[model samples]
Structures are given as structure tokens and as C-alpha cells.
Target: MILVPGLWLWRDPWLQWAAGCAGAIRAAGSQPVWFGYSRRVAWTAFLRPTGGTAAELVRRFLALYDRVRARHGPPSVIAHSFGTYLVTRALSDFEGARLRALILFGSIVSETFDWGTIVARGQVTPARMRNEVGAHAAIVRLAAALRRFGYPYGESGVTGFQLDELSRSVNVRYTGPWLADSALARYCRGVWVPLLRPTHPPRRSVLTLRSRELSRT
Candidate 1:
């Protein structure tokens, strides 16, 4: 699985998450190959430049698509938050970069369908997290348009952009609004990580991008 973390965090974060997930898969004796990417840009990367539109962001993302595909060799991707935009854009431009599945955690996809309006709505209240919002809504819409025909977006909307197109080869899993840090740490440190190692004698394992069960949080 190609693991991509949210912005500001190093690529290792997703590996950490995957490590936690590894325990679940290992219980079934599934050999998991976790992939990582440092290209995890900040949420703002999708936003418009002084004169650019969302299209510009897509163009740039497409330009970098090859590097990612070459590294992971068409992986089952897991993207959280803003990384969803990056994954969507990559898949839109390169059909051969087929994936097995896509798991989006706590996605900010709601903003992608109508970013301008979402921004405006937030402006009314002077929110603190405003700076994190970006051109993701626009990018997601563009990707959705390219990948499929009729997917729609809205508050509490079940249909998402680009997901159906992906479903042809990649199963799309959505686990949004995930319980915040407390839940995450519990899943990570408490459960996933512990189950991966030899239990009789506790030992510290060398953590790598390779498939291995990891602790969470």
C-alpha cells in the first residue's frame, strides 16, 4: 500500500498509521507492503496563485505524477486530509497508475465541491482553521469531472468526486471525521503497534516502510 500523510507531516506519518493497520491485516496473514511519499505538500498547495485558477494546480500535479507511480509501482493508496487532492490529481492524469484501493481518513473533501462558497461561509464566522482550507474543492471537482460523469457533492453527501472512476480498479474507502487524536493514539499506540512483534519477549523493531505491524498514537 502506498501511504501518503497529510501536509506539514513527514511521509513517515502514514507509515506509522499503516503499521498500526498492519496488525489488522497480519491477523489474516496478509503480506502488506506499505509505501511512503515525501511529496506530501501542504493544503495550501492547491490554492490559486495571484492570477492562477485551480486548473493550474492540476497541471502542476499531473507533471509530478510519473515520479510517484515509478516509486510505488501502482499501489493501494491511503491518503488523509489534504493528501486526497494529491492522490486524486495523480490518478486523473495517469490511467496506468492503477491502484488497488484508496482509503481517505478525515478528509476535507466537503470543501472541494465548492471551495469558494465554503470559504465564504467560514468568513462569516472568523474561524481559526481558515488558513488550512485551500483549492482542494476545485481540484477534487476537476478530478471528479475527469474520472466520471455524474458524481455530486454537498454537505452530508454520500457521492464523492472521482471515486466511481477509481472503483473500476480501486476500492475507495472513506473514514472521515475520524475521532480526533485520542482515538488515533489509541488505535495506533495501543493496538496496532503492539500486535506486530514477538510477544514472548518484548523487543524494539526497526521501523521501515516495509510491511510490518506498528503501534498507534
Candidate 2:
């Protein structure tokens, strides 16, 4: 399994989490390969993804994937945050059986990602976000933002925007928060009163990037 970390992190927890997950996979009779990437990134990049940024990340992961295959044969992958997104893009065009399972945790990917194309080559993205974070009001707020941008967001069993394809081998599980559908998620949700909402409208220029994102399929 390859352990990928989220934005702005490439070490420590990524390595530590890999150790723990590797232990588990070993216990189950598997060899795990933890792939690591950029250790740092400008925080502002999240708000404004540079053109080709995603493609570049995918290219890096593809290079690592090739190295992993040559050294350890096809192995299952486990990625978190941006790592998951990177892996997804890396394998989307892959046509070989050099991969086994794909387990994503806290994946920050759009729902419309081409899962079907990748699954045909044999790997699946987990669609268990909403269930796992339903109780965390903070996550709900985040998911809402994801939804506003047409990204996959909310509810257990929710496959927000992936292609209309299914994989029997796919394993989707909600392992935390589970707040999107919870009463607490609803109650503590921010900006309940419209009057309490931001008084000043955001600058029109600020909406340009977001508008482009939403306008895309």
C-alpha cells in the first residue's frame, strides 16, 4: 500500500501512517509500498490551483508507480488527501495489471473524477466521506464548500460525482465524523441566520476561479 499525505505535508504522518498501514497489510499477507511526494507547498495554492498543477502531481506519482512495479510487482495503494487525488489521476490512463487495491482516506478529489476509466484497469476510489464525518460540524462545513464547487460532498453511500460505474471489489466505508446527516451537524452548522452571513459581498474577481471550477464538468 502506498500512503500519500494531504496538502502542505509530505513526511512524518505520511511515513508514520504508512508504517501503521503497512503493518496491517503485512498481517494480511501483502507487501506495501508507501509512496511519498512533495514535502511542502505554498498554502495559497489551494485557493488557486496553478494550471498543470494536477497534471504535474499525477506525473510524479506515475513515475513512482513505475518504480514500485519494477521493485515490488503490482501493489495495493492507500493514499490520503492530495495523494489520493494524485494516484487517481496517475492510474486513470494506466492499462496494465500492475496494481491491486486502492484505498483512499480523507481524499480531496472531485466527485466527477473518471473512476470508471481507472477501474477498468482495476482500482477504485472510496466513496465514504460523508458517513465518516457526519458528526463533525467542521467537516460538514468543508463538505458544503466542496459541494458548492461541484466536488463530491455529503451522506453515507454517496457517490457524489463519479462516473456511473460499479465495482464489486470496491470497498467503501465511513470511519469517522459522519456529521453531514447528523442533528449536531445541522445545529452547529455555521451561518444559520441569513442576517449573520457576511454583510459585504465577496469581490467579483474573487469569484473568477470558483466560477471556472463550477462551470467545468
Worst 10 residues of 2 by lDDT: 188-197
Per-residue lDDT of candidate 1, residues 160-209 (tens digit): 33222312222123332232333444443343234322224424346652
- Model 2 off-target regions past 4 Å? 8-11, 27-29, 42-53, 93-98, 121-171, 176-217
List model 2 lDDT by residue over 4-68, tens digit each.
Answer: 55554334653434555555455544455655544444223234344365556666667777787
How do the predictions measure up, each by TM-score? 0.39, 0.55
TM-score attained by model 1: 0.39
| Most accurate candidate by TM-score | 2
